[model samples]
Target chain A: MSLEERFNEIVREYSERVYWHVRRFVNCHEDADDLVQEVFLKIWRALPSFREESGLYTWVYRIATNEALNYLRREKLRSALHFGSVDEEMLRRIDNDPYFNGDAAERALSKAVVRLPEKQRQVFILRYYDEMPYEEMAKVLDTSVGALKASYHIAQEKVRAFLSKVD
Target chain B: MVRKNDISTPQGYFDELKGRLGDIPHRDRRGVRIFAPWMAIAASMLLAVLIGNFILRKTAAPVEEDNGWDYISYLAQSLDPDGLPDEEFLTDVEQ
Candidate 1:
C-alpha cells in the first residue's frame, strides 16, 4: 500500500479513540477535538519511519497521551496568566452544555478526576473509561505494569474518597 | 425504602454526557497537516545516500603512480620475507 493510504487508514481507525483520550484529560469536547487532530497530525508526520517495534495502537495512544498532557499544561499556564484561576466558570459552562450526558454524580466524579495530578488522572481514564489492560497501558505509558496497577489503585481510592464526600 | 426518584441528580445527566461526547465532530483526515521536519530529514538522507553512491562509483577506478624501487621494496618487505620477490635486494634498493 502507498504511504498515504496507510496513513489515512490509521486516522480512520483511531481518531475517535484519540478524541476520547484527549477528552478525558481536558473534559471538553471542542478542546478534545482540537487535540485529537493535532495528535493525528503528529502521527502522520512521524509514521514514515515508525518502526513497528510496538503495536500501532500503543504508538498512537502514546502520542495522544503526550498531546493531552501538553495541552493541559499549556491551558493551565494560559489560564493562570490571563484569568488568575483555572476557569471554573468555563468548565461549568461545559457542564451545562446540552450535549453533556453525565449525571450530577458522574460530573462530580469527572471533576474529581480532573483535580487529580496529571499522571494519576491519565491512569484512571485509561484503566476505567478506556478499559485497557495494565500491560497495554504500560506500553502506551512507558511505565511498568506494577507501577500502572499501583497508580490505578491510588486513583481509584482518590475518586472514591472524593465521591464519598459528595455523598 | 428504595425509591425510583431517590437518584440525587436529574434523570437526563448521563444522557446529556453521552450526547455531548457523541456529538463531538469526528476529526476529518484533510484537516490534519503533517509535520514538515520528518519529511525534510528523510529527503536529506535519501539524497546523501544517492550522492555518496554516485561519488563512490565514479572514483572506483584504480590509479597508478610512479614510485622509486625503494618504496616498492619496503612494501615488499612488509610482506613475509619468505614471500619477498628475488628481483630486488632490500639493501641495494636506494632509500
Candidate 2:
C-alpha cells in the first residue's frame, strides 16, 4: 500500500484510541477532541521521517502521550498565571457525566487516577485501559522494559490503595 | 445467595462520546492545508537567513593579533620616543 493509504488506515484504527487516551488525561471532552486532532496532525507531519524501528501503535501512543502531557502542563501554567479556581462542582458533574462508562467503583478509581502524578497516571492508563504490553510501552515511552514494569506495578498498587480508601 | 447487579448504562454512552468527538472541522483542515506549506516555506527561509547571517558574522569577524609583542611594538613605535618610554635613554643619549 502507498504511504497515504497506510496513514489513513492508521488514523481510522487509532483515532478513537488516541481520543480516549487523551480524554483520560484531561477530563474535558472538548479539550480532548482538540488535542486528538493536534496529535494526529503532528503524526501526519512527522510520518515522512518515521523509520519503522518501532511498531506503529507505539509511535502513535508516544505522540498521544506527549500531546496530552504537554496540554496538561500548558493548562496548569495558564491556570497558575490566571489564578483560576478549581471548579469542584464541575468536577462532580464530570463524575456524574452521562457519557462516562465506569461504575461507581470505577468512577472513584478514575478520580483517584486523576490525582496521581503525571508519570504514574500515564503508566496506569496505558497498562490498564489500553492493555498494552510492557515491551510496546517501553518503546512508546523510550524507557527500559524493567522500568516500565516497575512503574506499572507501583501505579497499580497506588490505584488499589486509593480505591480501597475510597471504598 | 449472591446478588447479581446487572447495571447497564444508557444505550448511547459510548456513541455519545464518539459523536461529541467528531472529525476536526473542514474549515480548520482547509486552513491547515493552505497554511501548512507556507509555514514550511517560511520556516526554511528563516532558517536560511539565520544560517547566512551566522556565516556572514563568522567571516566578517576581525582577525586577532598573533601575539602581544606585535601589538606592543606597534604602540611603542607610534608614540614619540622622547615624550614616553625611556627617561633613561633621554638622559644618556641626549634628547
Candidate 3:
C-alpha cells in the first residue's frame, strides 16, 4: 500500500490510544488534543526513517512520551515564570480544567501524580493508569525494566502518600 | 474507583481528528530531502548560465569582423579622441 494509505491506517488504529495516553500526562482535553495531532505529525515525518527496530506501537509511544515530557517541562517553566509556582499552577489547571469531571478520588489521584517528578510521574501513569507492562514501559521510557519497576515503586509510594495527606 | 480516561473531550473529537489532521497539508519530507539538493544544483547551474550570458552580452566581443575595432571605434567616435580610453584598455577590449 502507499504511504498515505499506511498513514491513514495507522491514524485510524492508534489515534485514540495516543490521545488517551497524552491525556493522562496533561489531564486536559485541549492540550491532549493538540498533542495527539503533534504526535501523528512526528510519526508522519519520521515514518520513512522508521527502521522497525522496535514495534510500531512502542515507537509511537516513545515519540508521544518524549513530546509529553517536553510539553510538561515547558509548561512548568511557563507556570513558574507566570505564577511563581509550578505545582500550584498545575494543580490549578488540573482542577479548573473544563474537560476534567473527575470526582474527589480521581481528582486526588491526578493531583498526587502531578506532584511527582517527571520520570516518576510518567512511570506511575504508565504503570497505574495505563497498566502498561514493564517491558513496554522500558521501551517507551528507554530505561531498563529493573529501573522502570524501581521508578514505578517509588512513584506509587509517593502518590499513595500524597493521596493519604489530601484525602 | 479512580477510573482513568475520566477526562471528556468535545463530542466526536476522536472521530473527526483523523480527517482534520489528514486535511492539513503535508509533504513527503523524505522525498523533499532526497531531491532538494539536486534541484538546488540544477537551479544554480541554470542560474549561472543565465548570468554568464548576461555578463557576456554586457562585455561582448569588441572587434568587428572587418575593422577589428568596432567598440573602440564606437567609443572613439562617442568621446573626444584625446579623452578616448588608454591603449591598454583598448588592447584588453579586443575580442
Candidate 4:
C-alpha cells in the first residue's frame, strides 16, 4: 500500500484506542487530544523503519504507552516546579473534565487509579482498563510478565483501598 | 464496577482525526520539497555571490580623489627628482 494509505489505515484503526490510553494517563480530554496527535506523528515518522518483527498492534501500543508515560513525567515535573502535587492536579482535571461523564463511583475509581505510583498505575490501567493479557503487557511495557503481575497486584490493592475509604 | 471509559468525544471525531493524520505524509513531503536540489543549488549560488561581494568590498582599493596634483607630482618625480629638468632634456621636449 502507498504510505499515505497505510498511515490512514493505521489512524482509522488506532486513533481512538490511543486517545483513550492517553486520556487515562492525563485525565483530561484536551491533553489527550494533543498527545494522541503527537503519538501518531511519531508513528508516521518511524513507519519507514518498522520491520514488523513484533506485531503491529504491539508496536503501536508500545509507542502510545511510551508517549503517555513521557507526558506524565513532564506533567509531574511541571507541577513540582510550581510546588503542587501531580496527583492532586490530575484529580482536579478528572473532576472538571467535560468529557468525563462517569458516575460517582467510576469517578472515584479514576481518582484512585491516578493516585497509584506511576509504574503501578500503568500496570493497573493496562490490565484492568484495556484487559490486556500479561504477555502482551510485557511486550508493550518492556517489563517481564512477573513484574507486571506484581505491579498490577499492588495497584489493584491501592485502588480497592481508596475506593473503600471514599465509599 | 468502573467502566474502562465513560468519556466520549464529539460525533465524527475519530473520522476527523483519521483525515488529519492521513494528511501528515503529504504535509511532510511538501516541507521536504522546499529543500529540493534545485532550491539547494539556488541557495548555494546566492550565498556564494553574497560572500564574494562582501570580500570584494572589504579588500577593494579605496577610490582616491582625482585632483590633478598627484599626476603632476608623479610625472615630475619620474622625469626628475628635483623640481627643474636638465636643459638638454628641456630642449628635447621642445624639439
Instruction: Tell me the interface RMSD of every candidate, in Å.
Output: 11.2, 9.0, 3.6, 3.3
* lDDT tens digits, residue span B35-55, model 1: 466778999999999999999
Angstrom error of the Cα, residue A142, model 2: value is 0.7
Query: What are the DockQ scores of the candidates, in order?
Result: 0.02, 0.03, 0.24, 0.31
State each candidate's clash count.
11, 0, 0, 0
Best by DockQ: 4
Per-residue CA lDDT of model 2 for B18-79, tens digit only, reads 44333333334566699889989999999999999999988896887598997787677758
In CAPRI terms, where does candidate 3 land?
Answer: acceptable
**lDDT for each residue of candidate 1 in A1-167, tens digit (9 for 90 to 100):** 87667776776677656766677777666677678667877886788889887899899999999998898778779888887545473457447655467678877877778767788988998888788889999999999999998998999999899899989
Tens-digit lDDT string for candidate 4 (A77-124)? 999999998889999988998888779999999999899988898888
Candidate 4 at residue A159, lDDT? 89
Cα RMSD, each candidate: 12.8, 10.8, 9.4, 7.4
Candidate 1 docking classification? incorrect
The DockQ score of candidate 2 comes to 0.03
Query: Which CAPRI quality tier does the interface of model 4 achieve?
Result: acceptable
TM-score of 3: 0.72
Fraction of the reference Cα-Cα interface contacts (below 8 Å) that each candidate reproduces: 0.00, 0.00, 0.42, 0.60
Report the lDDT of model 4 for residue B73: 87
**Regions more than 4 Å wrong, model 4:** B1-5, B31-95
- Identify the superior model by DockQ, candidate 2 or candidate 3: 3
All candidates in order of DockQ, best leading: 4, 3, 2, 1
TM-score between model 4 and native: 0.77
Q: Can you tell me the DockQ of model 4?
A: 0.31
